[model samples]
Target chain A: MTQTRLVEVRQNVLKHNDVLARELRIRFQKAGVFVASFVSSPGSGKTAFLEKTLTKLRSQYRITALVGDLATANDAARLARAEVPVKQIVTGTICHLEAQMVSDSLQDWDLNELDCLFIENVGNLVCPSSYDLGEALRVVLMSTTEGEDKPLKYPTIFNTADVAVITKMDLAEAVEFDLKAAHASIQAVRPAMQVFEVSSKTGEGMDKWLEFLQAKFVDGQV
Target chain B: MHELSIALSIVEMGIEESNKRGGAKVDAVHLKLGRLSGVVKDALLFSWEIACQGTTLESSRLEITEIPVVVHCENCKTDRTIAEINNFLCPVCNAPTPEVMQGRELEVTALEIIE
Candidate 1:
C-alpha cells in the first residue's frame, strides 16, 4: 500500500463566488450606483415592499430592479409597472442568487444610467445568507404576520444583514404582533442594527425608509 | 438544501488539487466549518457522496471540524467565545459584543492523498 500523506490545500469553498462578488462591487462603485439586496421568506411582502419603494423613488432617482424567482417572470412584469427598467432572473432550481447570476443579468444594462439598483433575491431565509451578492447594503425583511421570533430562528441571516425591516404594520394590531418582542429579537441577534417598520398597503412609515435609502445613496456617492 | 452546490464546489476543488499532485488518489478532505457559516454538517456530508459520484473524488471521506462563534469584547479588550449564537453579549461582562472575531468559516484546510 502507498503511504498516505496530508497535503495542505487551504482554500475557501465559496472563493469563486466571493471573487465574483468583489469584482461586481468594484463595477458598482465605478458606475456610481448604490446596490441594495432584499432577502426574506416567501409571503413576507418583499415584492410589495419593493414595488412601493420603486414607485416612490422613481421621480427623484433613476432606479431599477432585478427580481429572482425559482420560476415565472411574474415579479418582473409586476415591477415593470413602476415605469423603470426591470429584469427577471429565473434561477430554476437554485435556492439563492449567486454573484455570477447577478453579474450575468446586468451585462446588457448600463449601470451608469442608474442611481440605485435593488436586487430581490429568491424568498429563502437560509441559503441566501451564505452567498454575497455584492450589495452595499443587505436588508432582511420580516412581516408582522411572521411572528417576532424569526430573527431568533434564523440568527445567521440576521447577523449578516445590514438592516432589518418590519413589514405589514397595518395588520400589527389585528394580528397582535408584539413590536417590542420583535425589536428585542433583532437586537439579540444583531446589536445596534438599524430597523424600519412599514406597511406597504397603507404606506405607513414609508417616508422614513425612503429618506434612509436616499441618505445611504448620498453616502455611497462619497 | 444548498449543501449540494457546496459539495459540488468541494469536489471540484479536490479534483484540481489532486491533478496538481500528479493525479494522486485523494483519501480524505479536511474542512473547517463554523457555526455561523449557515451550512449544516450532516447535510453536506450526505451531499458529498452524490457530488463525488463519477468523479475522481469518489469514495473520499470528508472530515469536518466545527468552529464555534467568537466575539470581541471591547470592554475587556479580548476575544470571547459566546455559548449562544443568538446572543452576542460577552458571557463574563454581559456587554454587547457587536464585532465578530471569528466564525463564519467554510474552508478546505487540508487534503489526505496516497503518495
Candidate 2:
C-alpha cells in the first residue's frame, strides 16, 4: 500500500513582520505622515540631533519620534521634553531595529495626529542597511571624530541612505576632519547624495535642516 | 551579531520547505553567500547550530558558497573580479564603476531533507 501525505506550506522568509510593515506604510501614506529613519554607529549623536530637530519642528508640525536602543528609555525621556509624544523601543540584545517593532509600538497613536514621525534606529551602520523600516526617507549620520573613511568602510549603509548628515562639525577642526575626503567617499558610493553638515551643540546649519523638514512634510506633503 | 537573526530566518525557511514535502526533517540547507554580502560566514555558521536547537533544522548542515565581487567597467567595457573590497576603481582605466554585476548576495537557494 502506498500512502501520500498532502502538505501545504508557503511562506516568505520575512513574512511574519513584513506584512505588518506594509500595512503600516499604507496607514502612514493615507494619513499623509512622512516618516524618516536615522541610522549610524553607536554614539554618533543621533539622539542629540533628533532632539534639536524635534524641538525646532514641534511648533511647526505635529511631530513625534520613536527611538530604539539596546536598553534604557533615556532618549525617549530626553526627547519628551520637546513636548511631542515619544516612545522608545528597547531591542534587548538585537543589533538592528526592524520595521515590525515600529508598527507594533505605534499602534496606539493616531497617525493623523502627527504630520511627521521619526524612527531613530538602533545604532549600527552595517546591519540596519538591510532592513527597511517603512520610512519615507533614510538618513545616515556620521560624526567628525569617527573618521572620514566611514562611508567607504561601510558603503552598503551609505548606498542605502537617501541622505547623509555630518554631525559634530563644531569639533571638525579639533579632530582634523577632512570634509573633502568624507564628501568624496560618500559620492563614490552614492553620487549626488544630499549631504548635510551640522553641529547640534552650536546649532550650526539648523536652519537648512529645519527648512528641509518643512519642505518634506509641510510644503511637499509627500 | 545579527547572525542569530539570519540563522533564525534560515531555520524558518528550511522548516517551511521541509513541511511542504510531507513534513520531512531537513538535513541541510544550501546558501550562496557572496563575499561582499556583509555577512560574516563564521559568525553565521556558529549562530546556525544554536538557532536550530528545538527547531526543524536541528540536524541541518549549512553549505555556503562564497561569490567574488565582479564589476563591469564602462570605461574599459570589460568585467573583472575585485580581489579586495576596498578597490572600487577599474584596474585598467582607473575609472570608477557604477554597476556591480555580481556579489553582495544573501539568499537561501535550496534545502536537503529526508523522510
Candidate 2: deviation at residue A92, Å?
Answer: 1.2
* lDDT of each residue in A13-107, candidate 2, tens digit only: 45555676677778888998999999999999999999999998887788899999999999899989888899999999988888778978988
Report the alpha-carbon TM-score of model 1 versus the true structure.
Answer: 0.98
Candidate 1 lDDT over residue span A80-159, tens digit each: 98888999999999999999999999999998898999999999999999999999999999999999999999999999
Candidate 2: what is its chain A TM-score?
0.92
Error of 2 at A170 (Å): 0.5
Off by over 4 Å in 1: none
Residue-level lDDT tens digits of model 2 in B24-71: 777777787766666779999999899889877786789887888788
Give TM per candidate: 0.98, 0.86
lDDT, candidate 2, equals: 0.82
Alpha-carbon deviation at B28 in model 2, angstroms: 1.9
Error of 2 at B112 (Å): 1.3
Best by DockQ: 1
Report residue B77 deviation for candidate 1 (angstroms). 1.8
